[model samples]
Target: MRSSPDPALSASSNAMLARARTTFDIEAAAVLGLKQRIGASFVQAVQKILEVRGRVVVMGMGKSGHVGRKIAATLASTGTPAMFVHPAEASHGDLGMIKPVDLVLAISNSGEVDELTVILPVVKRQGVPLIAITGRVDSTLAHHADIVLDSGVEKEACPLNLAPTASTTAQMAMGDALAVALLDARGFGTEDFARSHPGGALGRKLLTHVGDVMRSGDAVPRVVSGASFSELMREMSSKGLGATAVVDREGRAIGIFTDGDLRRQIETGADLRALTAADVMHVGPRTLRADALAAEAAELMEQHRITSVLVIDAAGVLIGALSINDLMRAKVI
Candidate 1:
């Protein structure tokens, strides 16, 4: 149609795309440049959060609400207890969620959501801490908050420059910075993360110990030093574990034999009928402490290039066996 419009004539149509790209690059650079903008007010905000006896109540309108939700989730997952409240909903009975000792985190591009502004007096009257994220340092919300985090952006991604795209991105990045800062300040550790996410895969990997997954005592597929090959086979088959531990007279693990060992012995033409547990067992197969973390055991198995491990207690007495399957079942994989 119309001579199929020349490909070179796509300039005006592509001008908006260039502007959008430039806007995004500038926004990303602005986020990276935030390190220089942070000051003592950031520390004061953290102190306000730490001292608050109640939950962090985050309120925003429209697009700001979306960012607030993410910020609340990040804060909650990292040790600080926070929840999002819609400014509109807060006016209607939902305000009850805001306790007197709570701290309010209000987010707005203009720093003037009518709903949030209306509730400002209430927050202040309760003696609650108020922190604001806004594009203008002297905006109403900023003036009201005890600490104001500037999230200004030079331009918008919209071609008309009317949308709040880059400004919102800058705000979201600042919220993440605050969350991580508080996480470090609170001394949030892996153990604390595990406690928060006990049912998740990472939690099981970090907190499930060798003792938690190991088959213990009689189920360890162990035999004494003098047990014959026939006795070893019976013990291995009954226990259903791939490997059997070899122990001394004192009932401590001395060595181990597995399906691999059986294959090697068969290849070597060793007489299975005459061999004893001590004669054929591979000495000192990979062993683990009962108290070792399941992730540590997994790492050890990977490091030593093995599948199964023997679990021994503090006294070095054979207590149990842990197989790769046990780790998978515990979600340590």
Candidate 2:
């Protein structure tokens, strides 16, 4: 059976995508337009959350609730304590979740859910600070809130002009803007995010330093300057690091001797049986700080076209040695 085309719309092959693209562009533009809406109310909202010693309690119904959950998560991750509560569920014993020290952030496009309206009185009577995110500034929730954040959209992306498409995206983007602004104000840094994501790849990349994974001290292949080539080979073979550091009398790294050095020396007909360590060691090999990120070490190795780098402290003393394989095994790559 053949399906008939709709009589009300164009039968063009690109019509569906064209319409969707237009809708997406409009929604994206609306999100960008929200910048003009920031005012003292935004500051008040942040101040309310900052002053509260307890968690920020967010309540909403329908699409707004979904975005509220994400906003709450972002807030918690960025140094602000927050949680989402369903307004309909609050009518049940779930209202016990509310406490005096908390701030309430309510989300509802119309700001007029019957359940939310019912709870608004209790929220006001209990002295819980209320921050409202709604399309209508004069609506019931916004009128009662200590601070009102308007997430107004000219129209929804829904072709039917009813579904919460552009409206919901605007709400979510506004929530993110607020959360990020507050995060910056609170001085949340990369370390704070790393602490929250301690078990993930980002944690390993940022928190794991060269010292944590590098072959240290004796395990690092090393040969004193002027040592015989045989002794250098023995150090490299014994340590299995494929490379040995040639240190000056002060114990600072002066050069490095690697497997490549041996191959080059042999190609040049250099007497490996009689050459000293300094005769073959390459000077000014790559060196990284002990505190440098393992990820950065991996980048340097790739950029320098080498498989290893020496870890040195501020004093220029060789403290550890790292290889590409070690970082790969640790999954820092």
Candidate 3:
């Protein structure tokens, strides 16, 4: 009962998709080309940035300026201290931001951006090492740079082949490669990364531990294994953790009783009043170490199809309890 699409519209859609695909292919090829360009100069740039006594100052004009800002952000977030300085601003007064111990990164597709080139003499006078990212190795920026990284591409994805499309793509890819190499050289680990990104989901996953979010002390519901069913229910309700740890005489957790277990018991028509904690609790219930990551606890909860879990110490003592709500509050869920 459905009609076919109009031929003209279909042709237009196909043409648009074709152009998009071509653009991606061109950009991909440009990025792939960059892998072969990474050699002594690339290593030198990374080393210079790492050994700098002050922050890395990145400079660029127009589209390269946009890419420069992103590169500075990536470097700062990944352990390297970096900042972007506009070339025009540097020529006016922003050059004061750069110290003699700082390293300069200059970005230009053609290596001929006047705004950037005008400050090369002043940068050199300050004895700052300059690293250039450019499409032309023999260009002005490259000639003056202490280290040169080639960001050349075969062609632009623009239909006119004039605008910066594949060129900027290559530059961005090269910048990322530089940042990652610096990160690896600095021995930057997840803990360092989490410190930089302390407000996001990634931060929560890396920095938040079970102990930080778990209910402890009086907030943790606990009962001895031999405790009566009424006593277990009272502990669970009063603590409101949706689960209670049933411990041995020595305070070692041996089982857990949750609201879900209560539902299954009621469905089976078990005599609630007659049962004790030992008779109703699930033995050897899934437990999380207090120091384990909240993300790990979230995964365990998902795997076991449970809403809550008990936290234990190395001695298997019931130290704390955590429910899905705790994870939600911690933004780890």
Candidate number achieving the greatest lDDT relative to the actual structure: 3
Q: Please state every model's RMSD to the true fold in angstroms.
A: 4.3, 4.6, 3.8
lDDT of 2 by residue, 1-333 (tens): 323556776768457756777798879877876778878988888777878999999888888889899999988988888999898899887788999898999998888888898999898888999998898898999889999998988888888889998888988988888788889888999888888777888888989988889999689999888999889999999998899999989889999998987888889986688888888899998999988999989999999889999988899999899999999889898
Quote the lDDT for 244 in model 2. 96
CA lDDT, candidate 3, residue 239: 88
User: What are the Cα lDDT values of the candidates?
Assistant: 0.86, 0.88, 0.92
TM-scores for all candidates: the values are 0.90, 0.85, 0.89
Regions of candidate 3 where Cα sits further than 4 Å from its true position: 1-14, 248-250, 267-270
Clashing pairs in 3: none
Q: How well is each residue in 1-333 modelled by candidate 3, as lDDT tens digits?
A: 323445767777867877887898899999999998789988888888889989999899999999999999999999999999999999999999999999999999999989998899899999999999999999999999999999999999998999999999999999899889999999999989999998988899999999999998888899999899999999989988888999999889999998988999999987899999999999998898988999999999899899998898899988898999999999997
Name the candidate, 1 or 2, with the larger TM-score value: 1
Identify the leading candidate in terms of TM-score. Answer: 1
38, model 3: CA deviation in Å? Answer: 3.2
